[model samples]
Structure formats: C-alpha cells, structure tokens
Target: MQLFSTHKLRNIQAQEQAIKKHAILVVDDEVANRKVITSILQYEFIVLEASNGVEAIELVQKHPNPESISMVISDQRMPHMSGVELLSQLAKIIPKSVRIIVSGYTDVESFIGSINKANIYKFIIKPFERADFLWTIERALENFELQQKHDTHLLSLEYIVAERTKELADKNIELEQAYKKLEDISLTDPLTQLKNRRYLDKHIDAKVGLSLKAFQNWQKDTTNPLPHNEQLTFFMLDLDNFKSVNDTYGHEYGDEVLKSIKPLLETLFRSSDIFIRLGGEEFLIVVRDINQTDAQILAERLRKTIKQYVFVVNSYTNFSITCSIGYVQYPYITEQPNALSWQQVVKLTDKALYLAKNNGRDAWVGLSHLNNNINENEITKLLDPDEILTQNNTINLVSNITLTIK
Candidate 1:
C-alpha cells in the first residue's frame, strides 16, 4: 500500500477539520498495520489504538463512557489473544461499538465461528483497496448511529409496558378486596352485626368434614391418640322469653336487647371460636378443642351473665334478661358403636337445649348418656353424601341441615 499523495494529504487534513465527532479503535499486534488503519480513519474520526485484547480492555476501562468510541477494528491473528477474542471482550466492555474483523484469507473461518458473539459489522481480508476500506468504515459508523436510535425506542417501550403491568396488578388487588367486602355484607345479620346463617352453612361443613376425617382416622388407628384435636362443642342458646319483651315494650326494645348482647358473647367465648346470631333472640356458639367441663363452664357463664346484667328497656324502666343454653360433647360415642357426624352432634345438642327449655329455662343442660339413641335412619343420615359446592378452590358441602328444638 502507498502513502497518501500530496494533494490527497491536503484533502485529508481539510477532511479531518470537518469530520463528525465520533471515535474509532483499531487493534492489531503489527505496528505497520495499525499505522495504515489509523492513517485512513484519522482524517474522518477520533482514532484509538490497542495492540492486544488486554490493551483494548484497558482503554475501554479508562473511558468511563464506552459510547464515546463508535467502531472497533480488530486483526484476527495475534499471540496471546486472537482478534475475534479481543472484539468479544470489547463487546462486553463497550457494547455500543460496531465491530469489524481484519484477517488474512486463511483466518476468515475463525471470524465466522465467533461472528455471532462479536457482532462483526464487516470482514476485511488482507490486501484490501483504499476505497473499500473507507466505505466499510463509513457504513459501520452509520450502523452504530442506527443501533443507538433502536435502543432508545426499545427502552421507552419497556418502560411503558412495566408501568402498565403494575397498574393492572394493583387494580386486580383492589377488585379482590371489594369482592370480599361485599361477601361479608351478605353474610352479616344487619341488626346484631354478627355472622348470619349463610356463614354457618359454609364454615360448619368444612369443620364437620374435618371431624369426620378425624373420626375415621381414630377408627383406623385405635391404639394411637386422637389426631390433632378432633373435638367440636356446640352451645345452642336462646333468650328464655324474648316474645314477652317484644309484645309488652314494643319490638324496638326487643331489638335493642338483642344488639346489646353482642359484646357479651364476644367476651364469653374465645376469639378463634366462631359466633353466630341465628336470628332475633336466638344465637349459637361454636367451640373447638375443648373438654366437656370447659364446654359446660362456658355455657353456664353465658346463662348467668344474661341473668345478672341489667337491660335498660326505656330511659325510665330497667329489667333483667335470662338465656337458656344447651351444649353437647362431639363424637358422643367415641367407642365406634356410632359414627357420629356433625349433623348428629347438632341434633343431640338441640335435644339437650329443649331439655333446658322444658326445665323452665334460665339454665344450661349437658347431654347425658340416655339421649344417645342410634337408630338406622340417623345412621343413614350420618353416612349420606352432602352436595359439595367448590368456591375459590375450597370445598363447601351443602347438607340437609336444619335445627329445631321441641
């Protein structure tokens, strides 16, 4: 290759003055080749030189902003590190640089192997013409500018997508909360602010399913201890004579008396236990993992609490109220003579409750051994399959569930 001619040299000097503001890096072990590459580009760009991959990496580290250098020209054949390897390292070091590989005819295959990794913009073999060399550099610079624009647009799109995704996720969370609120309102007793029968129809079935499973497990492993606290105690209670309060003092006074009892029930039972207001003047208390005595004690305390507390009728008149409670120990016959489901347990409790009502109210009665009447019909009822309703991945069985005391 020949040096730049006199007129060409003057033209190069003039071109350098008007060159656009961009940098180019040429890496080669041969000083002669570096000089040749630099001479052609020095007129049109800010030229940088590196003898090896190590030196190229050092230069990239020195310049904090790698985008300042736009093009990288690397010779493939080198001692410690090949040209392809150098460009590969430069990619990580300065990703914005458009890479070009300069190699001999024999080493063209070496660049092909790493072209995917190096993102080589052009491949120039040995003994290239000046016009082709200049043309390659010009195109590489143009591609670098186009790449910058693409990255900017891509970043803007990613930001917009991320923001939209977060907004949609937030909206889904709000919708779930609102749905829960509406569900609670539907299951609440308006007058007493207590969970109504709808809540019982679902929660009781889940608890009962657990009870049945435990009972089956106990039967299977009779020698082992009861599995995971399988006991459920139910207390059925009602105001002894709520109708008299309604008739004599009007329904408004009776309504107030029912609402007043909310705090008393909350205090009597545990926070974990579920409490339900069945309707006007009737309530149910559900207790779990308790002994027979503990169940009796809770029932007695509630009965006595109502009997003692003074209920203000009007501003002028104050009177006392009394409640009768009846609770039954679950799995009444643990010896397996009878497979007692929750429905049967409820029937036994209701029977005991009527016994309390029959014995002139204002008291609590526990189920005795005499009431354990296991007939064929009751056994059929216990084994019958309840209609299962699955909601939110939860299995809710709707049974032939009803309670009456007579």
Candidate 2:
C-alpha cells in the first residue's frame, strides 16, 4: 500500500468533516440534562437543544429545511406530549430521520407499549456513559446518510426502467408492422414460433429477385460498393440424431428442445434476416447484405453454441446437444447472378449439409464459390458427386474439418 503525503491527508480530513455536517435535535424538560448532551455532540455535529417535546416539535417546524435534522433524541417523560408521540409526529415531516429515545429505569414499562409505534432506532438509558452516548450518535447519523443514499439510487433506477420500457414499446410497433404483412398468409409454425417452410416457399423467389437486382446495380455503379455486401447467404442447420431425443425422452421434451433453437438463431442473425423451420429439427436462415467471410463465421459459431448448450428436459434429465450446418451464397458465379435457379442453389446448400453430417457432426461446411470457367454441362456434373467438383477444383470449400480442400 502507498502512503499519502501530509497535504493529501489534510484534504481527506476536510472531506470527511464536510460529510458529517448535519443537525441533531435533543429534547428534555430539564435544562441540565439537555446541556450535558449538547456539550458532548457540539464539536462533531450541529446540535439543537429543546426544553421539552412540544418545543422540539415547534423548533423542527420553524426550521427552513426539516431534512437537515438527521436525528432526534427525546426523554420518555415530558410535558405537553410524550417522547414516543413527538417522534411519531416528526416521522410524518422527515420520514428518513433516525429517532432515538432517552428514558429512566422507571419508564421501561411505557416502552413496551410504544416502541414500534414510534419506529425508534435505539434507546439510551438515563445516567449513561459519555463514550457510549457519543457512539450511539455516530451510528444514528451513519444510518441517516445511508437511507438518503438509498433513496437517491432508487430514483436513478426508476429513470433507467422508464427508458427501457419506451425502447421495448418501439420494438413492439415494429413487430406489429411485420404481423400486418403476414396477415394474408399463415406463416408461423405451431412449435418454436419461427416461420414455417410455407413462408419460405412463398417468398424465396422475390427474395432472390431483389438480391439479383441489387447486385446488378452495385456492379454498374462507378463508385464501388462495400465488398461481399451483395451476397445472399443461407444456412441449413439440423440437430445431430434428434430423433433419439423423442425416443429416450417423450415427444414433449423434444418439442421443448426444438423451441430452444429459436433464440439461438436470433442471436446469430439479424432481425431483418429470415428464419424458417423446414419441418422437424432442421432450420433454414436467410441472411442478406452480409459478406461471405462473416456468414461463414456465423455458421461455425452456431455449431459451437449448440454443442455447448445444456438442454434441460426435467429436474432429473439434462443433456448437451450438437448440430451440423451447411451454407451457400447466391450468384454462385458472381458474373452470372442468375446462372442457377433458386431451387438449384438450395439443392447445392443441401449437399453441403450432408457433407458436414458425413464428416462427423458438430461441424459446418460452406460452398463459398464456384470456378469461373465452368459451363452449364459442367455444373450438372458438379452435383452427381460433389467430390468431383472438389477433385477438379471447380468449387471453393470452407470447413472446420480441414485447413485445405482437395
């Protein structure tokens, strides 16, 4: 630990003294008793003396700020009103102020009736040691400062909650607009709440057409557009051996496992991207306006996330699941954006998915691009056995299984 200089120590002492500057009220019918308590506390705190419970209340009311009085100490027996009654009324004016009562042994019987009613902090018996009295005052002031700090923190948290609520309301409005577009067609799956295959079948054509148009416009512009932003990428994900889940556990548990994938998909893709449940445990994600490299990174991340996730079926059963992913980018030949039909492109992506499953599960395979020299006939040959394309170097392959493709 480092030691502070004398100058620095003085500054620290000044800050502490500033924080302790709060008024404390002392109430008693006898002038001698009030003087004794005032002399002990006057050096550390702003001490105010009151002749009785009635004068203490009047003094507190006439003060410019009631909150400045951090604590109140009163004798149990007093004229005009009792200590408990005075503190109870002061509670309404300064609810956070710490209250303490000073009473004699004879006054113990009255305390049993009024302790909770006054919300007293602590009791000081008559003929107390000076040291113990000062210690109690220090503790009561600390409690007062803590309550003030807590109220300040609560106000800040309330403001943060209000801001977050407004943001959630705006997101709900966006969802409402999306729901209007789906009004004409029933597109949601009963389980998982992701779009069903029917939604994809109806919209994939328009999606592809729009991507092709954007690519063409990007190519013609003299001012170059960002690289890889024109590609339309798709990911095909299937849980490895998901049927066994239903067999070992019930179908209800399997349904829960499927529902869990919705959030995982949302985590990896943007809201603008389309997600589809192509029946069973297979999911399709269409991500637009992303580069090929970033799309490949997302596919690998999704595979790892599924592998590490713990699927809780019940209190007794918990298991981890893994998935295989295959992805492809549209305009397989960038020069010829429409060289292959959308159906043909999907077929190629499906082939990659099988490749990942065959290589061993919990991995991703991507068909990044095809050779520029390949003709229409050669393209057909590429599919009979995808290995031929890999052998001939007709297409680019990306996978976590190998650093190089054959």
Candidate 3:
C-alpha cells in the first residue's frame, strides 16, 4: 500500500509543476524574429506566438484564465499597431500582466516617454544577450505579483474601516433615543401625564425673564398701539371639592379625574404656554402674550369648562366637577416692572384663589395691577388682598362673579 501511494503522489507533483509554468506571448510582424525569441524561451516558458497587435489582443481575450498569460513581449516597430500602443490596450484588459518592448534601434530616450505611457515593465534593445533577456523577464513578473498583493491588502483595510464606522453610527443613534425617553419620564407627572413641579422649576425663570424683555421692548415703542398688560400672566387653579371624589370613590377614580384635565387644558390654551400639575388637584398655567381683559376671559372660560365636563371613571361611574381660579399679570406695577418678584406675585395669586373659594366655589378672581404710589408697607399688605383691597383701594380686582368683593 505504501509503494502504491508513493507512485500516485509522484504523478500529482508532475501535474502541479506543468500547471505552474509561466505563459509568455511574443508578438512580432516578422516570422524569423518570433522564431528566434521562441527558441530562446521555449525550454523554460510556454511561449505563445502572435503575428501582430490585433492577433495578440485576440489571443489574450480568448484565454480561459486571464492570470495564465503572465508576460507579453512585443517588438516596437510593427504593422497596424506599435508595441507601446498594443501594451496600452492590454493594460486595461489584464493590468496585472507584465509587459516588455523590444526595439531595433538603440535610441532609448526617443521612445522612453511612450514606454512609460504604456506602463511597459522594461525596454530592451535588439541583439540583446540571452542571459540579460531572461533576467529582465523574471524581474518584471516579480514586480507584477507585488502590486497585486498590495491592492488586495488595501481593499481589505478599507472594508474593515467602513464596517466599524457603520457600527459606531448605529450606537450613537440608540444612545440619543434612550436619553430622550429618560428625560421625558423625569419631567412628566405619571398620574396626569402633565408637566410636574420639576419641569416648572426648570423652565419658569427663563420664561419669566424672556417675557420681561418683551414687555420692556413694547414699553419703549410708544408708536406701538398695544396695551401694557401684554405680558406673562400666572393662573393658580384648584378643584372645588376634589377630596370628596377620593373619599366617595377610591384613589384610582381620582387619578382618572386628574388625567382628564390634560385634554381640557389643551383645548383652551396655546401650545407655547406652560401647564403644570402642582400635586393633588391644584394646577398652574403660565399664559403668554395676553392683556388683563383676555386673561380674565380665559380664566372664566376654564372655570365654566371644568364645571360642565363630565369625569368618566368607568361604565356607570360619571360625575361633574368645578374649579376656582385666580390670575395675576407679571410686573404688577407698570412703572416699577421689578417691584415684586415672581414668587411674591404667585403668593398674591394664591390669595386671590382663596377669595374666589370664599365668595363662591366656582369663580375666577384677577388682580389687574397695583397702584403706582403704594408704599413698601402697603405692598407687603397686598398678599392679604381682601382686607388691603377693601380698605385702601390700593389693588384693582377683576372677577367673573357678581358682588365677588370679599
């Protein structure tokens, strides 16, 4: 069995050697010159012969394996096409193939530029020695192999870089979406899906500052025929008897009532305005770019809407609720725009809401503006709007209720 296997291996080695032999194509118009070069190379290489450039091109095009034609050797002077012209066309077909040009004359400088254009591997003068010709052919083939390897390695590196870039881009997009989701969760009230105290605290100062700039700009422009009340207005609202809803029904039903307020607020307010649920049944709205008259009108409308709309907890559980509201414009005194800070203004608004609750359950009260000449002590007393407003006539009040002066 060992003797039989050794004989089979020898046959396989011989076949591999024949397959590895280099194929050389020699193109020349003269039959004698073709025979001379073929005789020199035939022992080592598989020499293929072509009479001219056209025949040489046809042979290469018809070859089964393009890489099998390892080298092409052509004479410089030939009919129809010169050696440089033939090699330029072959460069487009099999760029990895080595090319050589043989010239009869020793004028190397004359055709050297054309040889470069054809990407010719070497220029040989005729009557060259057999040893020099063989050396030139071997060197050209080695150079061709090196270039092919370099191109393949560069392509592999480019592919890896492209894949890594795509992966990084995909990861960046995922991180952005996740961060957006977390931010939304942090700023929203889970029960009502309304803006929470954190959201209001984060944005109220900037909103107030921007509104102040707008109010100052309008004041400077005397030609602009708009009222000074065109500014940011804060509204504080409370459900009249919201605790009874939780007492009669469970807290789950009270949550449904809270959720119902989001759609109601959206219907009456502009998208640019801020709305927040300040825990329990109390809510806050920051109305933008409105005068006292329009602000009072909106406050009344919100009260009526809440009184009329039915809160549906389930198939058979339905009830109606009412809200008491109080509103105050920022820069309460137009002459002294920064007379009272926003926090103090909101406290006055809360006092007005208590006045509404005291006079009647479903009502809206507004503090239009404070007197320009009020003393600092009087300004401090403005928080208890009922006694100060009735005694001194220092604050002007607007309301939707009849005889609402508490």
State, as a TM-score between 0 and 1, how close model 1 is to the true structure.
0.73
User: Which residue segments of model 1 deviate by more than 4 Å?
Assistant: 1-22, 27-56, 75-85, 103-119, 142-157, 221-229, 244-253, 313-317, 336-341, 371-373, 377-406
TM-score versus the correct structure, for each prediction? 0.73, 0.52, 0.77
* Comparing 1 and 2 on TM-score, the stronger one: 1
Candidate 1: give its CA RMSD in angstroms.
Answer: 10.0
Tens-digit lDDT string for candidate 1 (274-366): 778987788887787776667766777888888998988669999997887777656665544245766666665665666577667887777
Writing each residue's lDDT as its tens digit, candidate 3 over 283-358 gives 9999878888789889989999999998877799788999999898887776566777788888888887887888
Give lDDT tens digits, candidate 2, residues 1-406.
Answer: 8786999888988876675598889998988889999998887888888988778888999999988899998888887898999999999988788888898845566676567898888878888999999998898888778878898889889988988998899889888877876753478887899998888888887878878887677668738753357678888999999999999988999999999999988887889888999889998898888777888789889988899899987798899888998888886777667677666777778878888888777888888554654577866865665443252356777888862333
- Number of backbone-clashing residue pairs for each candidate, in the order shown: 0, 0, 0
lDDT of each: 0.75, 0.82, 0.83
By lDDT, the candidates rank as 3, 2, 1
lDDT of 1 at 339: 56
Q: Rank by TM-score, descending?
A: 3, 1, 2
Q: lDDT score, residue 12, model 2?
A: 87
Against the true structure, candidate 3 reaches a TM-score of: 0.77
Q: Of the candidates numbered 2 and 3, which has the greater TM-score value?
A: 3
